[model samples]
Target: MTVRFFNFTDGQNVKLTAERGGYSVIEYQSDMSVNPYEAQLAYFASKMNVRRRQLVCHLDRFPSHCVSMQAGAMQWMSGDVQPKTGIRGAGDFARKLVRGSVTGESAIKPEYEGTGIVTLEPTYKFILLEDVTDWNGGIIIEDGAYLSSDASLTHRAEMISRPSAAIAGGEGLFNLGLYGNGLVALESSVPREELIVADLYDDVIKIDGSLAIAWSPTLQFTVERTTKSLIGSAASGEGLVNVYRGTGRIMFAPVATGHVSSASTGA
Candidate 1:
């Protein structure tokens, strides 16, 4: 297969091509060679925070984002050494979706191209460090976004806001939300095409469990117990679960419900 690249700086785009059957690596300028300990020092030196404009990398495939952690960047950026670990990536902070590809040095990743899949084409953007209102240790989100700590509550609330949607009941409990005009990223066990997205404005929808990845912040989330629980919830299939309310949208993967693993969170 042939590979190609387009370089853009300050809004200018430059196209570059790769040799047939060859691969190209994307990394920070000096990241590839810096010592892990030393890199960490530089990273911390850049204001004691992980984000450094001069140090981060601007790459294709998913807009411009920070490359690996300072140490990982050092290994991958420099000529020949493979990274020993994952970069302290900003994408991981928000459970941002990742494009399927061979990114880690230890394994071969899938290459994604020409497909407008959500995994590779997330609608989330970084909340500039300079403009943060409340710096939550986790993901950075905009005003109208709310992440789902537990699936049931988030999914139901999103449903209350929307109408006629279904999500996997088996995928475990975990999801992130974005609203207003910001970007959101999430990890997906299934590819974008396989995932389902239902938009609702003024209706309610219900499903067996929580598997939604995102919803609008306007929606409200809560927990509810099945009617059986009051008398004999054990007899009924449904149990105590999380709930949602209000209006917005929900994105989820019903196929992998309940089975979602933490290993895939920032994959």
Candidate 2:
């Protein structure tokens, strides 16, 4: 069948809008009647420079592909769509549980299939659509970056090779890894335009903090002192820093994300 969006707005109190991909973003316009306090807050927020929340919906047509999403992320599904846990047996469940524990992700993600539309629960964080193939077939993402992905892709948790990396880098012990070819959705602190990408050729890149959102799984991550000598490290005024070495690519959000919290936007 045909899909159409009517009277959709982009930016400036957007009520509804669709991107190039099979996804649509929705936002609530400020209205005094709904919640006067919130409306007033939103109005002043505009003045104070706070961003509005936006929600995303995945639209599927007949003979469409399946999508796997974070647990409890589905807001609603319509038409011939079906949901599955993608779990085969007890062994799979146990493995997923371990992965979830280490990666700090949901234990079980639901897969949606068939010819229908599925909308995810909205969040204040920015939504990013990326093709896994663009990252040389594999990508390791920071914890909680995952939102959804085409079912054809494989998901797992990858552990840091060195314990010191986990403890000193401030990036956690394990990260969510995605493989294969498919479209993936991510919840990012910053929008796509603000993101920076670095491609390495048997080289190294270092960051002062946990700013890299995702990186090629082929790269090695570790924590290192800014200078080789202790006196140099002290004089530099910077201590241990996260470093990515080897030939691969990395995507980073230069801005800090500590203050951002997840909040839902209705479909």
Candidate 3:
């Protein structure tokens, strides 16, 4: 297979470069990553647009950039909003407010109250996107799957209420697959190298940590505890397992340094 990179623009203020191959790689300047999407929503928005769900995905580790460069990328993100509906707020701005007791966060709240909707919150410190909560489409949570929808649809309600952990608590959990159209939130452990696609045939794949971010609703999952006989998982540490089988695309972190924030205790 031969691969070559080329730059082309349709003469808009926007220009992009794409690499060609069996499949084309088109990356907007990481700077304009959020803009093109907003333009698409704007051009296609409708009253029933409220029924069109938007599934937002964020990479836990944002693309690397230097001081000044990072600021430029964030500025591009700031202008990406073009919601014809609800009130919108900045994630960082909302975070500062959520962290602080500032009463002003409500000042920048979304412009409307019902139906047409757009809101902002952080899936992590890096990713932020507006999801059309009023839509009826079931959401596929890849990351920030914790965010919820206020739309009439019931599918995303699972994610809106719980994160990946919800699956364990009798709350039907899996990589959110939408049967109907509506907005939903998804959490993906690995976003850069993995994708969540659905296949008619069901297959199950499991991994170390909760790498199976999202999958179709048809897959069945079970938890298993490992005995001390299993190598490092038993001797050096503990082996906990989550087995998933069925058909669907699972997004897994290529590298599994699974850990929670290890804060130092003043021992």
lDDT of each: 0.29, 0.76, 0.31
Choose the strongest candidate by TM-score.
2
Better-scoring candidate (lDDT), 1 or 3 = 3
Kindly list the per-residue Cα lDDT of model 1 for residues 52-166, writing each as its tens digit: 1111122233232212221111211312223222323675322222311111111111222221211111111111111011211122221122211111111111123111211
C-alpha RMSD in Å of predicted model 2 compared with the true structure = 3.2
lDDT of 3 by residue, 1-267 (tens): 332323422323222222111111122222222376575554443221111111221211112110111110121122123322222347645543442232111212221122211223212111212232322222344432333322222322222233343444233432333344333333233333344443435565645455544444444555443443557556745465555566544444545523323211111
TM-scores for candidates 1 onward, in order: 0.36, 0.86, 0.37
Cα deviation at 165, candidate 1, in Å, is 23
Query: Model 1, stretches more than 4 Å misplaced?
Result: 1-182, 258-267
Q: For model 1, state the Cα shift of residue 238 in Å.
A: 0.9
What's model 2's TM-score?
Answer: 0.86
Candidates 2 and 3 compared: the better one by lDDT is: 2
What candidate 3 gets wrong by more than 4 Å, as runs, is 1-119, 122-144, 148-150, 156-179, 185-202, 226-238, 256-267
